[model samples]
Target: MGLARRIAGAVFLLLLLALGLAAWGRFRAPSAAERDALELLRVDSTPLPAKNAWHALWLLDYIIPAGEREAAYAQDLAQLRDRAVAVRAGTPVPPFRKWAENHYAALPKLTDDDRAAICRPVSQCLAQVRTHPEATRLALTRHADRLAAIAGLAGMDYLWNDMPPVTAAPGPDIGDVQALWLTAAASDFVEGRQQEGLAQACTSALTMRRLHVGGNDALGSMITARWAIEAGGLAMDMLAQMPDDAPVPAICAAAFAPPVDADVDFCEVSRAQWRGSFGSVENFPVVEHGAGGASWLLSRDQTRRLAAPAFVAACKADVRAAELADAHLDDAIQPRPTPDFIDRIGNVQGVDLAVAGVPNFVPYLRRNRDYAATLRMFGTALWLRTLKGDYRTLAARVAARPASVNPPGSRPIKAGPDGISLVMDLYAPVDGERVTTVPLPVPAS
Candidate 1:
């Protein structure tokens, strides 16, 4: 009986001790690794969310910028929710939907073969989209004042506070957004407004670039870089449409000459991923909203801690990957994928998809470098076109900008037997590298 009593008391004491340790672990200060991650993730606090291009984009639902300037975005959501509910319940289709169905039924704008022929390859479509009898360009121009306003704010910061993943939309086909700007630019050039035309072209690219630059999770940065480099393709096509004697402004060349990571820092983007993306998962009862994982806690923190090594490693990896932005694809260094693991303590904290945001940053880093290289080629080609005073001048001028003309062995200007086109060895993580050509519409003066 005495032995049984002692065993009972001992078990009770151990239980008490375990509970104390659990509670302490849950609330303990962040560790050295945690602090370093937090420091890297910290962001500037000034930009007003109202001015964010993210909110201003109508395709993203014209969010906070919808109602009267002072009206709450909640009002817009309430109206939209009620409308969506009504539609789902079999109410008559909204006029906008009818109109959209007429011109752009499914995404990729598969209105018909005619529309596709006119706008499928954005490089080919920028000049002709305006000519569609149904006022095809209106698909973009309908949001004219708003588009212009958003473009004007491109250089400003976009601050997206914590938002749940369930409510968040990954955003529309932003490639269409770039096409919109390039079309407007082509229109300006045709009207003999060269200065204003190129300025609009640069601004539109900048706007699309800013749309995703520091805003969304890892996917957001990739979208921005992907589309921005795409803008270079369309812009080159638009430039081809310009008359040979057309002057290339210094601003137009300067705007595109820098690296992709110039204005937005990829490391800071990971910080934001933690703040907002984790909030997406935190909506689940199992997660906490703080910036870092508390080691050994049987909660989301410890589960997400598995992502820490990858997130921290990204800062260094980005620098290394970017160094090879201009090198050949075979020469680009691949950062090893960091695996998520549970050291001796973990039992069964399930992995959250949101936790993968930082762990999966390697692809985004590679895309950034590729975009930088592609942009360099685009800028270098633009520079040569501006300098090409007469026939066979491209080679000499391309050689002059050694720093900008990467992988110089291969001539970017493909003056084929029939015509001349500016080309870049565009790199994609999946398809490897392919020569992307933008045919110049100008006569070789």
Candidate 2:
């Protein structure tokens, strides 16, 4: 009986210890890493320059010696962090300047008619504009300088990013408008400014594709690229049907060419997800008091440690998805489903949640490729419209199928009703026929 009682006492003490640890974890102070991450991530509260290159070859320049890029960055970051802390604690900080501010400030404010005109689809509105050109014309006339300024953005390479919004974070800073660059180009097209509109459209596509903002784990870049491609689609639809064979001007030539595909990467996105995994200390209380939010059962570092393996697994999966992206569009790559064992409802330790949250980039990648191929096929129509050739040459090219524009026997460039339209992965068949019948423009006789 004595031996049994001793064994029972030992078991009870162990149970108490476990409970004590759990309670402490559920209410522990934010770790140094968590504090540092918050300071760095919530950047708008401080005075660092734009996170990326600006219109005139700009990045936040740190003043340390060569071969010490990371060191310089760290030093600058430390100063910035200090300033942020001081400002938040009611201390005076030095004034800061950013070149992007001037450029944005110069943008023409949108008027009611201009906003409404931007909402109109350029292709459908052409006939409407020709007959009743008052509204668009008014917008065009009223905002001529604005139009010019917006068009000039095409010449300047820039990436518009507000960063993966911690807006849901406590006392978050206001974010910039997300789709202004895209909408600006669309508005230009809607207002009947063909040349400038094309230039803007091309620039928007190239900007997103060329210099994709790397840090944020959001698919905003890929999604925005598709939006730009769709805008190009709108352009193609408009140009193909136009009765007049408008010449692709010397300046607008490059804009008509199909844009290159963006390099597929989700590693940075994974890091962002990982970083945000640690719920902010400020917001933790709200989570703790409100519901069964992890108070958390593990410290921030412990949580990160537990979650790192899963993040790596998810990132590796993304890399594989990127490989499959290069394969044929219909190539089947199964997505990694969330592990079944993890409990989401009261998951204090988010071990597999990050892995599950990693987006399936496979579908989006194929769409981007199809859009690129379709744009290339549409490029042929643009060529025929502007670069009319001898009948023999034109007929030969047409007869050869879009092989003149694409490789022989590509699926998307297949023949359509009005000589050659398009068909892609996204295009669905109607009445048992899979085709998009676009009215390819005839060069004026």
Candidate 3:
């Protein structure tokens, strides 16, 4: 009897403790600064839920990649996976039957032959890209036209037709957005179609920029920024491979140029918002760090205010890093600070950075994009001079700074086996070699 009474008493004590902890958690308040910071952090928004237009795309089987036929193939795949159950029961699977009927009805009524007919031109163009460098420009033009047509059929033409600030209706398959542009740029450049390559590459860069521009949605914006970085890098690569005599119009360079002021302005606005989010929460619910499972405990706001401001600084750091990278694009030897914002931003808490209007990925993406564009532009300039005269002339031209041919760290250009090279370092050394030779095309024997 006594033991039972003791057990009841212990249980009562435990219940009382739990109630006390819960009450404390509800009342714990953040400091004034913390409140302001919380308000600020809350400024960035989630992407608007645009109507999914992917179903219309799925209606065209011939143009879409197999991986992208999710809606069209889902029902069929599920039925096949569950074939044994249906066979054993010798009964029609009602759900699969309905799904299959609906899916098949919606799919385009094109036979295999019809599908092949639609794809023949595209296939031929791609084959030309693969086989004959002599026919590159024509092949690329045909291919781009064919792709544009297919994109129209798939309801994705807006990506090419529209500019930034337009939403992809039934959002684009974000995974596949850059694939075609990257391929086009590489193929065109290798085939000696410099103008075409530049056009395609620039189009890709513009597309990426358009995808996220003017939207405060962090994830969507960052995704666009990442693709922009990739597209910009590929654009530079194409430019670097162009023959010296290849014409470079002002438009080509302008394509890769980002509106730096707009980006900086956006960051400033976001940082201000992150600093402001903390003002509304009276008490922050502190999670109790203990062994008997976690519980919230309300207490006097005790969070150190340093992390909030530090996080905002980190966001600003990412923008500045991007700006620095852009400033060096026309030169070789990309200038990087010894301790970059990327390094500092990485050390910041992920939540703080994300909430503070710059995710950790932004700095890394911006830095790489900037460096790639700069290096490629430098290579292109040197290659052009090499075509005009001998290696000595190339060195003299670089020294003279006839164009924006300055090297990073003011590293002097040296004569290479073929033409000239910069014995320069890159950000985040690959294979630990700082000096690399930029090979120029050899003259016809």
Candidate 4:
């Protein structure tokens, strides 16, 4: 054959070999047990029976940090040893008997070397249970140490370090879900190895924050806030496990710091004005001046006209409270605004008054006829009434005999609209006295 044909034959032979190798690999993939042992470092026997104790221990590991893992494991192991002793001493392991049986039954299936490896420690553990139950507790400690060593050998500590930061558009992504799954897998591994799972959780949280908070077009602020709260809660739980006297590193302490923009106040004048104007005129009756008699009389309409500004002021106050609640951080305590200060001009009583400015005539009656219809259209009557109710309840509670009714420096009382007025405090509380108060700008009536 010519040189070109010989080269073509050689290429064809190589391609054929590659295809054969690929087929062989597809057929020779590791079995489930082999794959699991390779991946998790232990065989998951008895798939039908859930590993309850193992799962609980895993959850504990996830919440706790690596530095505290061995200690926590030792404590848990001691308790388990005690329980096991009680079990062997005719203490019916009714709830756990099935689990114990399954675990023991699966043990014989392990290779002789694997059996010896696991059995040596377990036998030692059993002996301790039989004799010096208290001293046998150390077996748990030794087992934890061994597992930790194995994890270290497997480079498990790199799990979190190797993960890339998550960044995606506001919507969900399969990649993000996969990253979370991997984090969970790492968490499970750490738990199985009796290592700390907090690091895994923390890494996952940071990834979530990056995906949900730092990225543009990311999740809503509310979603980000929820995750932040959950992450902070987890950190707090871990911190709680440490002794109060234990010296906490500055970085760790800083993790618990509240997020910026925790407290916010916003004022909108236009909406407040509209609401107030609508409220004042809402329940009033329009009167028409007929060709009857020219007589100037103060009618109910005059009272309502005067109260329009007050109604607007109350609307402004309600808006402010809603804004405050939405923007305030979980740790913030906001006092309910007092009803007296809700509106400078109108009291709750004026909201239902008739239009008062015009002289009493036929025109007044005509205008009054449309009052209910206008009020219903404005949408302020119900909202303002609710605000009034909230203020009243808050006022009653706060204005009670003692200033210390709810306790000093406690969370601010939340008021529904009916009792909303109780929340206002123009002046900061001083040493047993109301100091000089700053006047909040009132909207035009």
Candidate 5:
């Protein structure tokens, strides 16, 4: 009986010790897990959510070619992916999804670097969808909503701040808005929302035009025209859903037309100027000057007749060009020509030559000259002229050109007839080198 009692007591003591150790471990394990969760929450609180996935994918895509040290970063990204899965599975994890959404919504308020960072996680979520397929569809759906919300928030921020101020003066703010809209529309399109993208792009284009007309500056007008062209290009690209084809004018006609408050005559004249100076029309007849000084219209010939003297003469005769020149000549020509010369020219032309506004021809010529150089460099003019004889065709030709033509930090100026000139400067890299050219095309009609 004594032995039995001693054995039982020993067994009881061992059981108690075992229970205590188990309790201690249970308490310590949660503290460690909580610490990790808190650290993750700190990272999630910042705008890093946006950049996490993108950075990871980019690193994975080109780390070796990029010559960067990214192995550890890649591993961290892998770990994050696992944690994100846990969060998605409703494992009582921290509010990573909500945190991401909030961070994304606040993206535009953050700095550019912050915005970039926020994009990363969204990209990773997308990548997850691709690999896991249907198993992760629900999680991806939620992530998509978060991404869309973030995009909407960023867009609103742009509309509020980056949009052109409603001032009496003209500026590039309208163009900036249109650009932002295009970016948003592209995001939507990539997410398989084509119709939504098209609608947004169209609306943005119209808004840009409306804002453009309110301004009085010639530069402002030119800038707005360029925006219209770009918006039209985007519409065509999206509508066609092809890489090579140009968008028909009808697609953008509703958006391109002048608003009710716009000057009808001025707008018509501007459109005509666009047609004459650049191949703004896809199928319009080209106006050619005959040897007898009579003008005749020519159809698409593809004979390199775009540079004919008659075509040049027609461009010179353009009323808008003349008006722009008259407006801006004084400012453009330094040490202004003698008053007598201006008066004599004025008398011959029955207009005040000395009177100047901004020259409309300046922008047109500048764009054309740059177009010519790009055509020469790419050897794509013939193909472009043959495919679709329009401004879109010309733009595509420019887009498809090799990037070697214009390197960084180099500016090229090409001069045309009558002191007209165009300047080309490099922007961001397209493939490997910067593509710098004025967005203009050889007049097709």
Candidate 6:
């Protein structure tokens, strides 16, 4: 053969070999045992992507420098801890300002007085929330600026695509700063600072709502809304503890607006978001077996084609289960079965439902909405108590406001055996009758 003909023959042979390997890679499925082992991939509970950038920014400023004397702000924390211990011993406590000092001095942009002004209200607000008898010392008007600052920091929206990829495990866990505003709101309400308390509560609620946003990563975005729901639940629990006749402030009423839709649309939106995030990452995890004991490692995609379909189908089912549960809430007598079938997809050889990080989010997203729905019910119950002296009058008042008394996701509120506290559950009594009970602790006479 001539030189050009020989070269063409070699090229054709290489093309044939490439095609054969591609075909095998596509057709070969993992063994049953390997499928079982793949479930281990689901255990990767790394921190949410937001933790990365937030932590880096926080440490650069608030972290104490090496070899420096502890700042006065640091001393304030120590003093507060000591004071908290003393309060337990029945020691007389001073006014809010005495036990703490402003500590936002670490920020370079604010001047000394500006920092002091900022820190002072935060300190006092925290003290009020901590249940100081002298909470009346600070005017509610003083904390307006501080609450604004806290709201600003809580974040208006969470942008998932902007999140830098997780290069390594995240740094120290930051306490949820938004909780402080919540505590302040609860304290103000109890102290008769209704307007201010409602403002603080509203700020916290709106801040939580801000976490809902659009992005490529569906699980991460929903995680933000889910967090808002959990936080809002805490706020509702606080309101429930108030007197039945306590006038509901307008801001509190507004804050009580549902943080997210509690219908089929929510479930559909969450599943679609997860779909966008599916397989978007370069480093998909894997399991390896040989002479050595089996282990898991994060490698770029090598066998995703063999595993992804079952994983995605499982994810869809899990999301659909939540939707189905919501759709039937109006008539449900028992709690809907939370789907965990995805987690046990291949149990025969011990590998259950296995998936990469993106799909692993389905379980978390599913549970979060449930918790959110329960919080919404708690708020509704509080609203009911505010209008009537109790929640049991719903049947008589249904015509006054049709569909006004939907329980949390069709699950009724069950008062504790003592008939004082409320919980979100449906225990025995399978007759499908509408169950009703007061969720709040009965106020003292």
* Residue 392, candidate 6: alpha-carbon lDDT: 49
User: Which prediction has the highest TM-score against the true structure?
Assistant: 1
Model 4 lDDT per residue over 1-445, tens place: 6999999999999988766654443234444433432233222222242212222222221334446544544453454555545643446543322222222221112234322222122113222233443332333243343233222312211111111111220122121222222223233322342123334333433433332322111122223333333333333333333332333334332332222211111112212222223222332333334465221222322233343332222123443343322222221122122222222222323222323321222221122112111211111111222232243333353434232223234233333254322222212232343211111111113
- Candidate 2 C-alpha error for residue 204, in Å: 5.0
State in Å the error of residue 245, model 6.
3.9
Task: Summing lDDT over every window of 10 consecutive residues in candidate 2, give the lowest-scoring window.
Answer: 169-178
lDDT of 4: 0.29
- Give the backbone clash total of model 3: 23
Writing each residue's lDDT as its tens digit, candidate 6 over 1-445 gives 6999999999999888766654443344555543442443333323354422232223333424323323333354355556555654457766534111143334233334333322133313334444553433242234444344445545433333323233222322224344434555656666777656656655565454544433234444454454454445545545555666666556555545543442212322333433323233422232444545333222222233334433433234444455334433221211221213321221211222123232333343444445444445545655556454434434433223223335334454444566555445422221352332334535545
lDDT order, best first, reads 1, 2, 3, 6, 5, 4
Question: What ranges in model 5 sit over 4 Å off?
Answer: 1-110, 114-176, 242-251, 256-318, 321-337, 341-361, 364-445
TM-score of each: 0.65, 0.55, 0.45, 0.21, 0.29, 0.49
Instruction: Give the per-residue lDDT of model 3 (tens digit) for 1-445.
Output: 9999999999999988766654443344545654565556656543343322233222332344445455444554454446534533345644323243443333233344323322132213334355654444443354553345333322222122111121111232343334444555556555667677667656655554544444343444555555554555555444445555556655455544434433332443234333333322311223335675333221122222323443343244544544444443222122211212332332223223223432243343343443443444444443454445544455554455523344344234454544433333444333353444443434434
Native-to-model Cα distance after best TM-score fit, residue 7 in candidate 4, in Å: 99
After superposition of all CA atoms, the RMSD between model 4 and the true structure is 34.9
Supply the TM-score for candidate 1. 0.65
Can you rank all candidates by TM-score, best first? 1, 2, 6, 3, 5, 4
Q: What TM-score, to 2 decimals, does candidate 2 have?
A: 0.55
Q: What lDDT does candidate 3 reach at residue 262?
A: 38
Q: Model 4 has how many clashing residue pairs?
A: 56
Q: RMSD, each candidate, Å?
A: 8.0, 10.1, 12.7, 34.9, 34.7, 15.5
Compared with the true structure, what per-residue lDDT tens digits does model 5 show for residues 398-427?
Answer: 455443333332234332222211223422
Runs with alpha carbons beyond 4 Å of true place in candidate 3: 1-36, 44-146, 149-172, 185-194, 209-242, 258-307, 317-424, 428-445
lDDT by candidate, in order shown:
0.51, 0.44, 0.42, 0.29, 0.34, 0.41
